[model samples]
Target chain A: MAAVDHDRAAQVGAQPLDVKAIRSDFPILDVEVNGRRLVYLDSASSSQKPRQVLDAMTRYYETTHANVHRGVYAIAEEATRQFEEARAKLARLVNARSAREIVFTKNVTEAINLVAHSWGRRNLTAGDAVLLTEMEHHANLVPWLMLAEERGIELRYIRLTADGQLDLSDLDRLVDGVKLVGVTCMSNVLGTINPVAELAEAAHSAGALFLADAAQYVPHLATDIQQLGCDFLGFTGHKMLGPTGIGCLWAREDLLEEMPPFLGGGEMISDVRLDGFLPADVPWKFEAGTPPIAEAIGLGAAVDYLTGLGMDAVRRHEVELTSYALCKLAADHPDLVIYGPADPASRGGVISLALGDIHAHDLSQVLDTAGVCVRAGHHCAKPLMRHLGVTATARASFYVYNDESDVDALSEALAEARKFFG
Target chain B: MPGLEDLYREIILDHYRNPRNRGELECPPAHRYEGFNPLCGDEIVLYLDVRDEKVVDLKIAGQGCSISQSSASMMSSAVKGKTLDEARALLRAFKAMMSIHEARLDAEDRELGANGQGADGEEAPPMGDLEALQGVVKFPVRIKCATLAWNTLAQGLDGANGSAGPS
Candidate 1:
């Protein structure tokens, strides 16, 4: 597999990286949950920050706690440098051509909102459609919905195959009248990784702009915006073992220039007057207020931590862990109904399931009692729940810190929940 | 202290496995109200037939955890045949009991608390076998599960009375 992308592997991972040593870098994994050793399997929701990321954030707040690009003072200069350096680091992680393409925002939700308001509202009109899939997170779904309603644009949905793959057969039909396509690179609930490159090609062939929500995929695998061939991409820092308050929107430099500014505020402007004020270019036009400074620095450090471990290795580790978990779950707990594909390679590390005679919430509670923390809900993907023919499901997601032992613990706890409830 | 075994008592499991009033209500004099607990994805629809200001009949149907479904079954029996105001009182008493362990409703104020807010938005818990759900308050995540049925009941009354918006 490494030979398949030998050039990429040569640039990124010629030297073998020790993931166990990298796991040691994250101190939060050493804590206890309800008297049980912490097995943090909820990285799909939000990852645990490593020691370096935490220390970087704390060090910034302690020493360089000043406003960025202001005051003409040494402290402000240092803060601005730290902030821009973080942008540069994010650019490297996403394989962006320039740091100017990275617009710091609150989270992936805010980043998507910027595009919906600035790009979609202005370019889209009545009869124009925005093609999306059934697999999108609500954050990606609702903004387009609001924009479509406001702009009188049609919202078209691409369906999903029974095997949980994207129903790309009708992509051409769905994008016939579409102006833009907003899709998820990976479904958080189903854990299916969509082929972003091919989807972007389809979307472009239909003459539509594409925005890929990289929230779930960016955390586990390496991302190259250029290779993905999407005009815009959005992701949150929290899900990638960074601090919570920061995220990025990576748009093609030309596309950012073409779209108008989303919000108006102090820093986004080159100059302001009562008459005809002009907004700053590219990333600055989108970033409207005081950007999350220390958090961005932490995200930069988190990217450093991930890069040090090598994302391919991390991807391989999660594949092995989730595959082992799925087999153990089906083999031991015959009553458990694990949703999505049986093959680990077909999905990411997320495992959604239901215990016999027990609702997902009850299953979650039983797991929690044994200190096996997992998510129990519709996961903000209610449409997917309906598609799966169930009310809700319990999900356990794995990351670099996760191993076979953690899956073993979840397996034991799940059997216990079923027996106690059954 | 006895682990999940303490939470999933035999009676609770029995009620979950074979729920009472488990199907959707037929369209008849009954008005329906659906309540959702977004956190746990538990949902319940309470159907009510009100006549002469009394609950002539009641049934609940939904998919949820044992705490939610069992609590709904208990509510159907407790609120049936009770006056609308009396049913309201039961809900207030039950909610209070679940939220505050030691809260005891006074005979006279129970009706007042149910019809309107108590002090500081702290109305008494709804009354009935719903009180068995008091154990859910100990688990913050399950609190929504236990309240799914009661909230739906409040909504059904709101639809009947036309002021059920807040519930």
Candidate 2:
């Protein structure tokens, strides 16, 4: 199969990326969906776990089923080692300076909230503004909106260009008065990949903190927090072919030290007092409760799996798949109208479309009937939908496991539906 | 054996292709109702040209799936020339039939089943022309797809959010 440039996968000012063998790692692609062979294309929402990841979790629960950091028992020690090992894996995945900078949360949503509650509360003044984007997922958007309102800070959005790319013209304008710049690395709806490094540089130049919602980007790309120069990066394990209930936030060492702890508990406090109690250092201070130990272990396995396949390879595969999907959807289904960047060279692997006169929900049903699983709705980007002049879009987001044949099945099913309706 | 295919039979396809009563009421004083199914985001704009509480003509104009478009076409033809009370009763009957799939409709029993056209074959509820929508039951996700228009009609007659233009 010929590999071509994907719209979102084309990284400006970045090195060459690879893809292909990564698809072999995920075993769920061999299964069936709706009584037909599965083509898991919804990786933008959540990715399917590989056999290695699943086995790692099962091995943890089966062989080393014990609590971490507290138990004096041998199994407890093993659990603690494995848990820390997962942290080490995550730290390495993002090239963090230390594992201590990684605080495990439930998902990226919780991680963002941790920043908003503690960092925003500490840094924001009454008139300070937080710069965001209109294309941000609710997880990335709502937290800042709420925190801004509560702290008397104004929330400003950087609009997207007509082609769905970030409108960089207002970068200085929006970054000027803003104290924080929170943007998505990749859009779930439009598949527009933001240039995180450039945005981070702009944020720092303006003396504003930059945070990346790496949920949609991290799984496919090799992420380096130090290289990107981002102040903070948040992502979930589930979206990266790992277990749910495990997420991570990597904050700069100095930022983590300066910001107040998100939650205080036994693990997060070294000493307590009646009037004054000092919180423990960086990661511990943010993680207050018994985290998802098994999930963290599974995430370690997932990182290992992705690393084995290589992030470059994953990105390349997705680029090829998205490009193929765009061409197939256009050529095969003439009635279909794909949203976002017209060329696959401009967007992520997410293929969002409206098929003729069919409502997105109805199209989703018809596709489901033919065992083509896709997501249809406002996709949590309601404001973006209003901007796009459509109610909802049928999205088929590809990952490592999907291939050209999956796009064929999707195209065939869509054609069947259009013919049936017509 | 009349199956799901029969629901999407030639007649239903004909109605879907060339929908009847599909326009705005011309120079008329009548209430218009619009309904939307947010789950799938299907919208139906139903115009009721009423004369002294009687629906002299009912018009619907919108684009949606076959279920929605067909239902809109069905609703238009079903309610035309019917009194407000009769229309409401018919709507209530259709709603009941939609919710309770097993219980046969009195409408069907009075129309063809009792009139000696069909017997042993249980009469699928004649939800006016909406009987074609029975295939929607198999696809539970699309049940709302078929009911978008009827739900709007229900909201309008109940006197709520209607007569306003769609945002």
Collision pairs in model 2 = A7-A344, A7-A345, A7-A346, A7-A347, A8-A347, A18-A312, A18-A313, A19-A313, A41-A397
lDDT of 1 by residue, A1-422 (tens): 21124224533554544657867988977877778888777889998888999999999999987988676988899999999999998999889999999999899999999999888877988888888888788889899889867878888888888888888887777777677888898888988878888888888998989999999988877788888888999999999989998999999998899889988997889989899789987788888788888998899999898888777777767776777898888898887878777777767899888887577787777777677878888898887888898888889998877787788889888887766755
Give a tens-digit lDDT track for model 2, residues A1-422.
00123223334423333324455556766677667777666777788888899999999999998878889999999999999999999999989999988989999899999999999889887889899898988898888878767777898899988988889996878799678899888889988878888888899999899999999878877777877888889999998899999999999889999999888777888788998788887788888978789999999999998887677666766776787788777888777788777666445788788987676766776677567888988888877887898877889988767778889989998887787776
TM-score of predicted structure 1:
0.92
* Segments of candidate 2 deviating more than 4 angstroms: A1-27, A148-152, A263-280, A342-346, B1-38, B41-126, B146-167
Q: Which candidate has the highest lDDT of all?
A: 1
Report the TM-score of chain B alone for all candidates.
0.74, 0.71
The local distance difference test score of model 2 is 0.77
Candidate 2 chain B, run of 10 with poorest lDDT: B116-125
Instruction: Show where candidate 1 strays beyond 4 Å.
Output: A1-19, B1-6, B100-128, B162-167
**Model 2: how many Å of interface RMSD?**
4.4
Going through the candidates in the order shown, the clash numbers are 15, 9
Instruction: After the best TM-score superposition of candidate 2, give how far the Cα of residue A249 lies from its true spot, in angstroms.
Output: 1.8
